[model samples]
Target: MSKGLKTLLAGAALLLVWGALAAYTAQMSLPSLGGGIAYDPLFVPQLLIGAGIVLAIILMVQGIRPLLAGIRIADEEPQKTGRILFVIVAVGLYFAAMPVLGFPLSSAVFLLVFAFALGYRKPVGLVATAILGPLVIWYVFTAGLEAPLPAWPSF
Candidate 1:
Protein backbone atom coordinates (compact mmCIF):
# COMPACT_ATOMS: atom_id res chain seq x y z
CA MET A 1 0.00 0.00 0.00
CA SER A 2 2.30 2.75 1.35
CA LYS A 3 5.79 3.09 -0.11
CA GLY A 4 7.71 1.89 2.93
CA LEU A 5 5.30 -0.95 3.45
CA LYS A 6 5.70 -2.00 -0.15
CA THR A 7 9.49 -1.89 0.12
CA LEU A 8 9.42 -3.90 3.33
CA LEU A 9 7.09 -6.45 1.79
CA ALA A 10 9.46 -6.86 -1.14
CA GLY A 11 12.38 -7.37 1.21
CA ALA A 12 10.36 -9.95 3.13
CA ALA A 13 9.61 -11.83 -0.06
CA LEU A 14 13.30 -11.92 -0.90
CA LEU A 15 14.16 -13.14 2.58
CA LEU A 16 11.61 -15.93 2.35
CA VAL A 17 12.99 -17.02 -0.99
CA TRP A 18 16.54 -17.07 0.34
CA GLY A 19 15.53 -18.99 3.44
CA ALA A 20 13.72 -21.58 1.41
CA LEU A 21 16.77 -22.07 -0.74
CA ALA A 22 18.97 -22.46 2.31
CA ALA A 23 16.65 -25.01 3.81
CA TYR A 24 16.59 -26.99 0.62
CA THR A 25 20.37 -26.87 0.28
CA ALA A 26 20.88 -27.98 3.82
CA GLN A 27 18.46 -30.88 3.46
CA MET A 28 20.08 -32.06 0.25
CA SER A 29 23.72 -31.80 1.30
CA LEU A 30 25.74 -34.69 2.63
CA PRO A 31 28.00 -34.46 5.67
CA SER A 32 31.38 -32.93 5.02
CA LEU A 33 34.54 -33.45 7.03
CA GLY A 34 36.26 -30.36 8.43
CA GLY A 35 39.21 -30.42 10.82
CA GLY A 36 38.52 -34.10 11.62
CA ILE A 37 34.95 -33.13 12.55
CA ALA A 38 32.08 -33.85 10.23
CA TYR A 39 29.71 -30.97 9.50
CA ASP A 40 26.11 -31.70 8.65
CA PRO A 41 24.46 -28.76 6.98
CA LEU A 42 21.04 -29.45 8.48
CA PHE A 43 22.21 -28.17 11.83
CA VAL A 44 24.15 -25.31 13.40
CA PRO A 45 25.30 -22.61 10.94
CA GLN A 46 22.92 -23.38 8.09
CA LEU A 47 20.01 -23.65 10.49
CA LEU A 48 21.03 -20.39 12.08
CA ILE A 49 21.21 -18.71 8.69
CA GLY A 50 17.78 -20.02 7.83
CA ALA A 51 16.40 -18.72 11.12
CA GLY A 52 17.84 -15.27 10.44
CA ILE A 53 16.24 -15.21 7.01
CA VAL A 54 12.90 -16.17 8.51
CA LEU A 55 13.22 -13.40 11.05
CA ALA A 56 13.99 -10.84 8.37
CA ILE A 57 10.99 -11.97 6.35
CA ILE A 58 8.77 -11.67 9.42
CA LEU A 59 10.02 -8.16 10.14
CA MET A 60 9.45 -7.10 6.55
CA VAL A 61 5.95 -8.47 6.61
CA GLN A 62 5.19 -6.79 9.93
CA GLY A 63 6.41 -3.43 8.66
CA ILE A 64 7.54 -1.98 11.96
CA ARG A 65 6.95 1.63 10.90
CA PRO A 66 3.61 2.66 9.46
CA LEU A 67 4.36 4.67 6.32
CA LEU A 68 6.25 3.59 3.23
CA ALA A 69 9.03 6.14 3.03
CA GLY A 70 11.33 6.47 0.06
CA ILE A 71 15.01 7.32 0.18
CA ARG A 72 15.63 10.89 1.29
CA ILE A 73 16.30 13.09 -1.73
CA ALA A 74 19.54 15.01 -1.77
CA ASP A 75 19.39 18.74 -2.55
CA GLU A 76 21.77 17.82 -5.33
CA GLU A 77 21.36 14.22 -6.43
CA PRO A 78 24.63 14.32 -8.43
CA GLN A 79 26.72 14.80 -5.32
CA LYS A 80 24.98 11.90 -3.61
CA THR A 81 25.52 9.75 -6.70
CA GLY A 82 29.21 10.64 -6.73
CA ARG A 83 29.56 9.75 -3.07
CA ILE A 84 27.85 6.41 -3.67
CA LEU A 85 30.12 5.65 -6.59
CA PHE A 86 33.18 6.54 -4.53
CA VAL A 87 32.07 4.24 -1.72
CA ILE A 88 31.56 1.36 -4.17
CA VAL A 89 35.02 1.88 -5.62
CA ALA A 90 36.60 2.10 -2.19
CA VAL A 91 34.94 -1.08 -1.00
CA GLY A 92 35.74 -2.87 -4.24
CA LEU A 93 39.40 -1.93 -3.95
CA TYR A 94 39.46 -3.12 -0.35
CA PHE A 95 38.07 -6.54 -1.27
CA ALA A 96 40.37 -6.84 -4.28
CA ALA A 97 43.35 -6.31 -2.00
CA MET A 98 42.14 -8.74 0.65
CA PRO A 99 43.56 -11.92 -0.92
CA VAL A 100 46.89 -10.27 -1.70
CA LEU A 101 47.46 -8.10 1.36
CA GLY A 102 44.92 -9.87 3.59
CA PHE A 103 42.03 -8.41 5.61
CA PRO A 104 44.04 -6.24 7.98
CA LEU A 105 46.00 -4.46 5.30
CA SER A 106 43.01 -3.94 2.97
CA SER A 107 40.74 -2.66 5.76
CA ALA A 108 43.43 -0.24 6.87
CA VAL A 109 43.72 1.15 3.37
CA PHE A 110 39.94 1.58 3.17
CA LEU A 111 39.80 3.45 6.45
CA LEU A 112 42.59 5.73 5.39
CA VAL A 113 40.88 6.48 2.10
CA PHE A 114 37.59 7.19 3.88
CA ALA A 115 39.29 9.48 6.39
CA PHE A 116 41.03 11.51 3.71
CA ALA A 117 37.84 11.78 1.65
CA LEU A 118 35.92 12.97 4.75
CA GLY A 119 38.50 15.71 5.43
CA TYR A 120 40.52 14.15 8.23
CA ARG A 121 43.73 16.16 8.50
CA LYS A 122 45.97 13.83 10.47
CA PRO A 123 47.32 11.03 8.32
CA VAL A 124 48.73 9.39 11.44
CA GLY A 125 45.36 9.17 13.18
CA LEU A 126 43.67 7.86 10.07
CA VAL A 127 46.29 5.17 9.73
CA ALA A 128 45.89 4.21 13.36
CA THR A 129 42.13 3.95 13.14
CA ALA A 130 42.28 1.95 9.95
CA ILE A 131 44.81 -0.50 11.36
CA LEU A 132 43.16 -0.87 14.73
CA GLY A 133 39.58 -1.30 13.54
CA PRO A 134 40.38 -4.25 11.30
CA LEU A 135 42.69 -5.78 13.90
CA VAL A 136 39.92 -5.59 16.50
CA ILE A 137 37.41 -7.16 14.16
CA TRP A 138 39.88 -9.84 13.24
CA TYR A 139 40.52 -10.60 16.89
CA VAL A 140 36.82 -10.80 17.67
CA PHE A 141 35.94 -12.96 14.70
CA THR A 142 38.95 -15.26 14.79
CA ALA A 143 39.79 -15.55 18.46
CA GLY A 144 36.37 -15.02 19.96
CA LEU A 145 34.36 -17.07 17.50
CA GLU A 146 37.14 -19.48 16.48
CA ALA A 147 36.23 -18.88 12.85
CA PRO A 148 39.39 -18.44 10.85
CA LEU A 149 39.38 -16.11 7.88
CA PRO A 150 40.02 -16.84 4.22
CA ALA A 151 43.76 -17.09 3.79
CA TRP A 152 45.64 -16.24 0.62
CA PRO A 153 47.27 -19.59 -0.13
CA SER A 154 45.40 -22.14 1.92
CA PHE A 155 47.70 -22.12 4.85
Candidate 2:
Protein backbone atom coordinates (compact mmCIF):
# COMPACT_ATOMS: atom_id res chain seq x y z
CA MET A 1 0.00 0.00 0.00
CA SER A 2 1.12 3.54 -0.69
CA LYS A 3 2.27 5.56 2.29
CA GLY A 4 -0.50 8.07 1.70
CA LEU A 5 -3.13 5.34 1.78
CA LYS A 6 -1.67 4.01 5.01
CA THR A 7 -1.69 7.48 6.48
CA LEU A 8 -5.27 8.07 5.43
CA LEU A 9 -6.43 4.77 6.92
CA ALA A 10 -4.65 5.45 10.17
CA GLY A 11 -6.18 8.92 10.37
CA ALA A 12 -9.64 7.52 9.72
CA ALA A 13 -9.21 4.95 12.47
CA LEU A 14 -8.00 7.62 14.90
CA LEU A 15 -10.94 9.84 13.99
CA LEU A 16 -13.36 7.03 14.62
CA VAL A 17 -11.88 6.36 18.04
CA TRP A 18 -11.91 10.03 18.92
CA GLY A 19 -15.55 10.37 17.85
CA ALA A 20 -16.56 7.37 19.93
CA LEU A 21 -14.85 8.73 23.04
CA ALA A 22 -16.33 12.17 22.50
CA ALA A 23 -19.78 10.75 22.14
CA TYR A 24 -19.36 8.76 25.32
CA THR A 25 -18.10 11.81 27.15
CA ALA A 26 -21.02 13.88 25.94
CA GLN A 27 -23.43 11.38 27.41
CA MET A 28 -22.11 11.95 30.94
CA SER A 29 -24.58 13.83 33.14
CA LEU A 30 -23.60 17.21 34.52
CA PRO A 31 -23.63 17.69 38.26
CA SER A 32 -26.48 19.62 39.88
CA LEU A 33 -27.00 21.18 43.29
CA GLY A 34 -30.46 22.40 44.34
CA GLY A 35 -31.66 22.48 40.69
CA GLY A 36 -28.64 24.56 39.60
CA ILE A 37 -25.98 23.22 37.24
CA ALA A 38 -22.82 22.71 39.27
CA TYR A 39 -20.18 20.95 37.19
CA ASP A 40 -19.57 19.38 33.81
CA PRO A 41 -16.47 17.24 34.08
CA LEU A 42 -16.30 16.08 30.48
CA PHE A 43 -16.49 19.53 28.89
CA VAL A 44 -12.75 19.99 28.36
CA PRO A 45 -12.23 16.43 27.19
CA GLN A 46 -15.03 16.79 24.63
CA LEU A 47 -13.55 20.01 23.31
CA LEU A 48 -10.08 18.48 22.97
CA ILE A 49 -11.52 15.38 21.31
CA GLY A 50 -13.48 17.52 18.87
CA ALA A 51 -10.29 19.38 17.98
CA GLY A 52 -8.44 16.09 17.47
CA ILE A 53 -11.16 14.84 15.12
CA VAL A 54 -10.88 18.01 13.04
CA LEU A 55 -7.09 17.60 12.77
CA ALA A 56 -7.48 13.92 11.83
CA ILE A 57 -9.85 14.86 9.05
CA ILE A 58 -7.36 17.40 7.79
CA LEU A 59 -4.63 14.73 7.77
CA MET A 60 -6.89 12.36 5.84
CA VAL A 61 -7.61 15.03 3.23
CA GLN A 62 -3.89 15.77 2.81
CA GLY A 63 -3.10 12.06 2.39
CA ILE A 64 -5.61 11.67 -0.46
CA ARG A 65 -3.30 13.24 -3.02
CA PRO A 66 -0.36 10.89 -2.46
CA LEU A 67 -2.76 7.96 -1.99
CA LEU A 68 -4.30 8.56 -5.44
CA ALA A 69 -0.85 8.98 -7.00
CA GLY A 70 0.37 5.67 -5.53
CA ILE A 71 3.62 7.23 -4.31
CA ARG A 72 5.30 5.59 -1.30
CA ILE A 73 6.57 7.85 1.42
CA ALA A 74 10.32 7.60 1.93
CA ASP A 75 11.35 6.00 5.21
CA GLU A 76 13.56 8.23 7.34
CA GLU A 77 16.03 6.04 9.21
CA PRO A 78 13.72 3.10 9.95
CA GLN A 79 16.30 1.33 12.14
CA LYS A 80 15.55 3.32 15.32
CA THR A 81 12.84 1.00 16.66
CA GLY A 82 15.11 -0.30 19.42
CA ARG A 83 15.88 3.20 20.61
CA ILE A 84 12.16 4.02 20.58
CA LEU A 85 11.43 0.96 22.69
CA PHE A 86 14.16 1.93 25.11
CA VAL A 87 12.64 5.37 25.55
CA ILE A 88 9.24 3.85 26.23
CA VAL A 89 10.70 1.56 28.88
CA ALA A 90 12.56 4.45 30.46
CA VAL A 91 9.34 6.49 30.68
CA GLY A 92 7.58 3.54 32.27
CA LEU A 93 10.34 3.22 34.84
CA TYR A 94 10.18 6.92 35.58
CA PHE A 95 6.47 6.72 36.33
CA ALA A 96 6.91 3.61 38.45
CA ALA A 97 9.63 5.27 40.49
CA MET A 98 7.84 8.62 40.90
CA PRO A 99 5.94 7.75 44.08
CA VAL A 100 9.04 6.50 45.83
CA LEU A 101 11.63 8.94 44.55
CA GLY A 102 9.33 11.98 44.11
CA PHE A 103 8.74 13.91 40.90
CA PRO A 104 11.87 16.11 40.94
CA LEU A 105 14.35 13.33 41.62
CA SER A 106 12.72 10.71 39.36
CA SER A 107 12.30 13.17 36.51
CA ALA A 108 15.95 14.21 36.73
CA VAL A 109 17.07 10.59 36.64
CA PHE A 110 14.76 9.86 33.73
CA LEU A 111 16.05 12.88 31.80
CA LEU A 112 19.64 11.79 32.22
CA VAL A 113 18.88 8.21 31.16
CA PHE A 114 16.77 9.34 28.21
CA ALA A 115 19.44 11.78 27.01
CA PHE A 116 22.12 9.14 27.12
CA ALA A 117 19.91 6.56 25.45
CA LEU A 118 19.32 9.00 22.57
CA GLY A 119 23.16 9.24 22.02
CA TYR A 120 23.76 12.54 23.79
CA ARG A 121 27.45 12.75 24.73
CA LYS A 122 27.94 16.11 26.45
CA PRO A 123 28.40 15.33 30.16
CA VAL A 124 28.12 18.91 31.43
CA GLY A 125 25.07 19.74 29.31
CA LEU A 126 23.38 16.47 30.23
CA VAL A 127 23.99 17.05 33.93
CA ALA A 128 22.71 20.60 33.73
CA THR A 129 19.61 19.66 31.81
CA ALA A 130 18.80 16.68 34.04
CA ILE A 131 19.12 18.75 37.21
CA LEU A 132 17.68 22.05 36.04
CA GLY A 133 14.78 20.74 34.00
CA PRO A 134 13.10 18.88 36.86
CA LEU A 135 13.82 21.65 39.34
CA VAL A 136 12.18 24.19 37.06
CA ILE A 137 9.14 22.02 36.55
CA TRP A 138 8.91 21.32 40.26
CA TYR A 139 9.07 25.02 41.06
CA VAL A 140 6.44 25.88 38.45
CA PHE A 141 4.03 23.28 39.72
CA THR A 142 4.65 23.65 43.42
CA ALA A 143 5.25 27.37 43.76
CA GLY A 144 3.60 28.96 40.76
CA LEU A 145 0.58 26.69 40.50
CA GLU A 146 0.36 25.83 44.21
CA ALA A 147 0.19 22.16 43.31
CA PRO A 148 2.26 20.01 45.63
CA LEU A 149 4.10 16.99 44.30
CA PRO A 150 5.23 13.89 46.20
CA ALA A 151 8.13 14.47 48.55
CA TRP A 152 11.37 12.55 48.57
CA PRO A 153 11.43 9.41 50.66
CA SER A 154 12.15 10.14 54.35
CA PHE A 155 14.08 7.59 56.32
Highest TM-score: give the candidate number. Answer: 2
For model 1, residues 60-143, the per-residue Cα lDDT tens digits are 855645443434323332356787888888888877777777777677777888779968979788877998888998889889
lDDT of 2: 0.82
- The segments of candidate 1 whose C-alpha lies over 4 angstroms from its true place after superposition are 1-78, 151-155
Model 2 is weakest, by summed lDDT over 10 consecutive residues, at 32-41
Model 1 accuracy (lDDT, Cα) = 0.71
The sequence of per-residue lDDT tens digits that candidate 2 reaches over residues 1-155 is 55687678888998999989888877877663443323455657767898999999988987798867767786555556787888788888888899888987888888898889788999999999999998998899999999999868533
Global lDDT scores for all candidate models: 0.71, 0.82
Q: Top model by lDDT, which number?
A: 2
Pairs clashing within candidate 2: none
Per-prediction backbone clash count: 2, 0
